[model samples]
Target chain A: MDKKKPKKVFVQGAIPPEKIANSVANHQSKTNIGAHSIFLGQVRADEVDGKTVTAIDYTAYEEMAENVFHEIREAAFAKFDITCAHIYHSLGKVNVGELCLFVFTSSAHRRIAIEATNFFVEEIKAKVPVFGKEIFEDETHQWKVNK
Target chain B: MKVTVKYFGLVAEAADKSEEVIELSEVLTASELKKQCLEGLAITDKDSVQIAVNQNLDDAITIKDGDEVALLPPFAGG
Candidate 1:
């Protein structure tokens, strides 16, 4: 596999569930992979004050974010013996209970795939220039900070 | 010298603009420029903001002509 090529990481709005299934089906031809680890991030309906979060309006420094995502992919490939890795994140409004982020990693063993997936998730949360605005049911909003 | 400054997320909302080009009469490091751009903004935690010069996160780097600078708020990705 060409590991150095940077893949598009951002998708508009919410990522469809069918995309995940299609991704899994596409990898069936690669017989060298024995395990696949997936991580899906869903928008949560958390109550703040008296209102509940209805959605998140995600935004990013797109140019910088793409670079950071590429860097994260390179680092993960260097640190783990993984067959492949794929990441997708939402760029616009994603409603509650909808998928916002998807991380998929495949490897010859289960441990490496799991570890690579975790690495991608943590790095993305810490390093990427993506931001989220939590919109409440009453149309009010607040900036979301990663803990 | 002039440099293009970009803002994202809360910073953009606070600034009311996504991008702007500023003319610098004196040399300023990335952090200094960040502060200048963010002056009077309503962002509560200015310390949590970060500056990126030419797509690399570094506050110590001095701003140069035609450089791309970005003001980034806290990341909330997964």
Candidate 2:
């Protein structure tokens, strides 16, 4: 069989809330999928040293990031009995309380969908080389590191 | 040999530029190249920095001419 084509995963800026709804609507035709799980990552308004974070400017080594994302997708499919999975991440600036990353998975059962979604989230966070610059309300900025 | 070096996140901020080219007479491991790049920069967390030679994040590999090297800081993706 031919290889499954990798979907484009990066959006220009903050991911719109309506995109989630659209994704679900698009999947309605796949009748065999009995369960779906979705994970959305929102930028938090974190306070650091008396400054409140207002937004995060995200950037990445795009070529490498895309390759890593494809690998993560392949690994998820290999490890789970999922029917399909979709992942979207934001580039550029994303304000606090806005969505930045979305992971959606579908399967014949709920357990597989949920587990696959979780795997994608963890792998993306640990392995992808995307960077974030937290801009404070006062306009000062600091680099963000995932703990 | 000339190599293209790219920087991202805090490393880019410290270096004051995103990418550049450096000419070298002898081959160097990714670690050695990263050290040279950070010599005059303001980066303090050397351990957190990783070097990718031609998109492969392995410092033990030898860098060659025209290869793309990236200095990546700690990943902060969600």
Candidate 3:
């Protein structure tokens, strides 16, 4: 156990790959990790029932969402013997085929990281307050929220 | 209390905006907003709606002055 408290963040903004890469480097330096699994979610240019998805406008109830995200992260750490985890998601109007989310988890072994990554994505989808609007190429649009 | 109601995803289609302010008293809640939404607009499937107050999922949340509320429909993004 370290003297400093662990950091949990939920940011409703765009994420740069370099920042995440740097954070991962920091985590690896702290732990003798054998495996680091990363999951990236990218928006795709496609259609919803014949309407092509040209762009996605994302929005969030930022304060509440951050609170929920931080709590979930703490729960994950309590359940897994992981070195570190990070989740970054985007906000505002994201064009078709843009990266919106990244989940990186590192642990002492491959098995733990893999399982933890899966759990991370699942919990995020179910719990996080992020929302998106799927914009069709034709100009028609629809809201994108969890079922 | 006057609070703003925001619509997102499918819910936005129904309300047709990111958010709007309505004159409400303390008795007004998130659920009442859904009803008002249906009455003000021709929105269907009121039960399928998801409500957020100040950005978190608030099904039965109460309203306050200057609070912003968001209405969302079934999430379809990954």
Best by DockQ: 2
Q: Encode model 2's per-residue lDDT on A1-147: one tens digit a residue.
A: 112677788999999999999999998998999999999999999999999999999999999999999999889888998888999999999999999999999999999999999999999999999999999998999999999
How high is each candidate's TM-score?
0.98, 0.98, 0.76
Candidate 1 residue-wise lDDT, B1-78, digit = tens:
999999998999999999999899999999999999999999999999999999988899999999999999999986
Q: Give the Cα error of residue A144 in candidate 2, in Å.
A: 0.5
Model 2: how far is B18 from its true place, Å? 0.6
Worst 10 residues of 2 chain B by lDDT: B38-47
lDDT of each: 0.94, 0.93, 0.71
RMSD for each model, in Å, please? Answer: 0.7, 1.3, 3.6
Candidate closer to the true structure by lDDT (higher is better), 1 or 2: 1
Runs with alpha carbons beyond 4 Å of true place in candidate 3:
A1-20, A145-147, B1-4, B25-29, B52-69, B76-78
In order, the TM-score of chain B in each prediction is 0.97, 0.95, 0.77
Model 1 interface DockQ: 0.90
Q: Relative to the unseen true structure, what is the C-alpha lDDT of residue A20 in candidate 1, on a scale of 0 to 100? A: 98
**Greater-TM-score candidate between 2 and 3:** 2
Judging by TM-score, tell me the better candidate of 1 and 3.
Answer: 1
Error of 2 at A10 (Å): 0.9
Per-residue lDDT value at A117 in model 1: 98
Candidate 2 residue runs with Cα over 4 Å from true position? A1-3
